[model samples]
Target: MEIRALVFDVFGTVVDWRSGVAREVRRQLPGVDAEAFADAWRGRYVPSMDRVRRGEQPWTSLDDLHRASLDELLAEFGVPGVPADARAELVLAWHRLTPWPDSVAGLTRLKERYVIASLSNGNVALLVDMAKHGGLPWDTVLSAELFGHYKPDPEVYDGAARLLGLPPERVLMVAAHTSDLAAARARGLRTAYVHRPAEHGPAATPPPGADPEADVSVASLTELATRLSA
Candidate 1:
């Protein structure tokens, strides 16, 4: 099927989320071990999501999960003296995630030819804030909050298709993560991989053999846009 709209995964896909988070954390705490704190905080992400998925806790957005994780990570890292108000300040960090350098320009190229939206696990509010902060230029934002499900869940993928008034095959899901593309591919959405190798850090490694499975793989959004625009 021909691809039309390009839907993106925000965190770690369009943006180097870990790097951005680490930068923010570092900026907020001068001369601190920012990278260590970034890794520590991100490492808590999945288990927290699992808690929500398993019904151990009520539905929570990514922002709330970040806050919960922050409290644990700060305590573990022995970061001293963050007031309650300061805690609220840190929780909003996700709102200002920085975009990958190629992101805005690449999305602009693709947008000239195709509709672009974010099909991410982030809630609409968070995605909106990030878009505004980063000048992401999305035609619309499609988050898991709309379907109350997260990525790798079929509903979120299908929900985006339904919301866009398109069939599964006509929409393309672009991301740096293979598992994300696998989920989209399983549901008939075309899959594209735009590499964000530094996503996990300098030593980050790509998942073995997953790139070939993508309809196309490129090093950056600009490259993806070039191919799609061709």
Candidate 2:
């Protein structure tokens, strides 16, 4: 099938969640290990969503999940001095994430040739806010909240293809995480890996190389644009 659309994993792929969250954490709680705090918050992301995915809990938005996790972490990190209003604002940090250096220009290039959209676990409102804040240029915003399932859940990937009126093979799932790509591939969607070495934090190690299971991989979105253009 000819590829027609590219759906991206927003958090670590298009946006730098670690630094973004850490920056907000530092602003809210000075004198803390912001990077480690960011990592710890993110570490709970999948597990938090898994509860909903497994039907152990009702469908919940990522925004709600982030708040729940944030509240718990605040207490754990002994930062209860943060006011409720401030904590609410801090939880919105996910909405204010910064895009990778090449993200905007690269997505613009790819958008010219493909229908680009977000395929993320973040809710639609969250994606919209990030796109506006980071100047992300997406044709549409698709989220697990829209389909009632998170990534690694077939429904999310399949739902994106369905919404675009394209077969699975006609849509490429782009992400920094190999596991996300693998899940998309398992559902017959093509996969592209974009390496994001510092997504976890400044000290995080880079992906060794292009993932063996990825149908295609590149160091940056700009490089992916070049490869697709060729």
Candidate 3:
């Protein structure tokens, strides 16, 4: 099927989550190893969601999970003097992520050829705030919060296709993470991989330039747009 829609994984793909989180952490905790702190916080992400997926916890938004995880991370790091209001505001740092240099231009081009939307584990409100802050040009914001299921879950992928009124094959899932692309492919959506070596940090390794598994793979979203538009 010809692709009619492009659904993106926002964190680390469209936006620089690592740098953004690290920056916020440095601002909030002056003496902290900001990068390490950012990685540790992000490291808890999957486990927190896994609890929900495994039915150990009730359905919850990513924002709520972030807060829950943040409480633990702060305690572990032994950070000092953060009041309740400040803690709450700090958790909203996810809302202030900055977009990659090529993100807006690439998405704008792709938007002309396809219905562009975010298919992320992020809550709808979080995605909305990030979009506004980063100038992301999504046609719609689709989130796991909407379906009560997170990415790598069949429900989230199928739910996005359903909401767009398109068959799974007609919606391309674009992500920097291999597991996300793999999950979308399993749900019958075409897959495009974007390389984001710096997602974790300067030492983070990049994924292969080409993958037999991915229908398409590129160094950046700009390249993805160029190929898709060809």
Candidate 4:
């Protein structure tokens, strides 16, 4: 089936979360290794989600998870002079993450051809902020917060299609993370993988046990845009 809508994964696919958060933290707390802090904080994400997935902890929104991780990292690093309100403000940094060089342009091209929306684990407010900050032209923002579920879960993919009034095959899940694409593929959606070689950190490797199979793989969103245009 022809793809009419493209559902993008925001974190590393569209927005450069690692660099974005690091830059913001660096702006606030100068002469510090903000990139290291961003890496450490993001490192906590999966295990934090694991606790909820295993039912060991109550379900929490990504916003809370971002805050919890931020607080832990702040205490661990002994970073000084932080106000209480800044904690909330700092947590919102994820919302305003910067996009890749090609993200806005490539997505703009894609948007001319298809409906574009975010299918991210980020909350709606977070997604909205990222869009505004990064100038992402999205038709809509969809998040796990709305569904009370996260990616790698079939509902997040299938449910999005249901809401968008598109069949699974008519929607394509485009992501930098292949695990995300795998889940979408499981739900009968077309999947495209865009490579963000620096998504983790300068030295970070791809996540362990990622799927080798994807319907499409491209060097960057620009390449994906070009291919889809054809």
Cα lDDT listed for each candidate: 0.85, 0.91, 0.90, 0.85
TM-score: the better of candidates 3 and 4: 3
Per-residue CA lDDT of candidate 3, range 1-230, in tens? 79999999999999998889888888877898989988998999999999999989999998899999988988999986777886787689999999999999999999999999999999999999999999999999999999998888999999999999999999999998889999999999999988887788877666666656899989888899999983
- Runs in model 4 with CA error above 4 Å? 206-212
* lDDT minimum window of 10 residues, candidate 2: 200-209
Q: Clash number for model 4?
A: 0
Q: Summarize candidate 2's per-residue lDDT along 10-42 as a digit string, tens digits.
A: 998999898899899889889889998999999
* Candidate 1, superposed: residue stretches over 4 Å from native: 206-210
Report the lDDT of model 4 for residue 106. 89
Candidate 4 per-residue lDDT, tens place, 128-213, comes to 98898889999999887777777877879989999989999999999988788888999999988887888887787765332368
TM per model? 0.94, 0.97, 0.97, 0.92
**Candidate 3: C-alpha lDDT:** 0.90
State which candidate has the highest lDDT.
2
Candidate 3 ranges with C-alpha deviation above 4 Å: none
Instruction: Give the Cα-based TM-score of candidate 3 against the true structure.
Output: 0.97
